[model samples]
Target: MDSGGTPEQVLMGGSMLIGTVGAYLVLGAYLVQLQHYCLAGAEGKRKNRLTLYILVGVVTVCETLRVCFITFAAWRVLVLGIGQPVLRQSPAKTAPSLHILGSFIALFIQGFFAWRIWTHKFNKILGAIAVLIGLLTTTQLIVGVLTGVQLGRIGAIAEQAAVTAGRNGVFNQFINNNQNPGGLTPFAISVGILTSTVFVCDVLITIGMFSIFHVYRKRSMAPRAKSALRVLSINTLENGLITSLCAALTLILYYARVHPWIHMAS
Candidate 1:
């Protein structure tokens, strides 16, 4: 399992988990605050607050799913041992698909919120970037699922061969040859590309967030409104930063060939 890799790797993985958890918790709290503020406000602001609630709900669900996927991947790695066939169809392949789906949901929610804020230019720019990233991520997920299905079929054939041939036939050769190949599959390449795209998307989101915060600061809203926006901005920035750090760690592990379990779980 490369447990002996540099201490940095261990710390990085632990920190990634902590950061993701913390970000989600803060986001949840911010949503609750929004709900309270919305209830206290006049009828005119209630509609906007309801929209924010829906957007926050979507983000919460997406992030929760993402954490669940990561946790499952880690659990599989621990149980199966590194490089073992954790899935007949390969969970490594399936994980990216979930990630892509979650990313798209998050993008949609964020775009909706940006639009509500009436930052038209920032909304357009962020929307475009989010759409591009979401498309690439979804493409990668589809590719991974297809590759995993093919590998599963091949594994099934090999297993049947072993049973019929008594372990000393072409089935052994097939199993040996298909032992993931270190980095030869389209799935692996797609994962790499998706990881890189995530980094770029994170950068753009950060910029958009900062721009939004600047606009919020210049407004002459009530103190409560100002405080709410500040809280929202802080939570959003933390979430974006944590996501980017995790993506970067996964990207580094992929290229270093340190084994997929360093990023995946089983």
Candidate 2:
């Protein structure tokens, strides 16, 4: 199996690409909302303006942190020649923070979806299920973040050992010690759990929201309204499918040993 490049380069380079694309998408969504507001006028905008701004702000803040961490990690690796251990350690520390923030944003977005569903159907049970699932994912992410912090602490210890044993020796030691309690297996398991939970939450939210939209489309009598609803339903489903696929792939990569890169990229 040819892996192509050093994992450090693969991870950092992949993150750079993801972050750039994410920034564009985040800003683009905001821009689209703004453009719609401009064309549709204040009354149409008033209903959604606050929510759109909140989405933009939350995504912007999360992406800012992501870019900052990726930039520093890249500088440390490529420019400073910090080696594999530092690359692994540095990103491991920051990745969970990003994961937590991303999960928080997901919760907010999913909750909004639940609220919308409830607003349409007035179904407390459905909304409660959506919110409950969102909370479940958030809790899992919090635990995963804590586990990652512990992993980072372990990495820091390994880093100290590396300083004494020299750069190349670090990998050798990790390979030997990875079965120990404070080693690679635990971190991988945590990541797997985290990503899986995220995937589940996304899938549930997608189903819930799409179901609501489907009902709305079926119930509408006016052709124009039905057509507009169809467009929205398609967009919602498309976006959810993309996000759910990413989450699924991220878990697959975690188990496959791609680790931090795939998670960051997603």
Q: Which candidate should be chosen as best, given TM-score against the real structure?
A: 2
Where does candidate 2 have its weakest 10-residue lDDT segment?
A: 168-177
List model 1 lDDT by residue over 87-117, tens digit each.
Answer: 3223333454354544465456445543433
lDDT of each: 0.52, 0.60
For residues 106-220, what per-residue lDDT tens digits would candidate 2 score against the true structure?
Answer: 5666556656665665466666766677576567757656754654665566566655644433432332235433444555556666777778877877777777878888989
* Predicted structure 1: lDDT: 0.52
Query: Poorest 10 consecutive residues of model 1 by lDDT?
Result: 168-177
Compute the lDDT of residue 33 as modeled in candidate 1: 59
Give me candidate 1's TM-score against the actual structure: 0.54
Residue 245 displacement (Å), model 2: 1.6
Off by over 4 Å in 2: 1-52, 82-96, 122-125, 166-185, 258-261, 264-266
| TM-score list, all predictions | 0.54, 0.71
TM-score of 2: 0.71
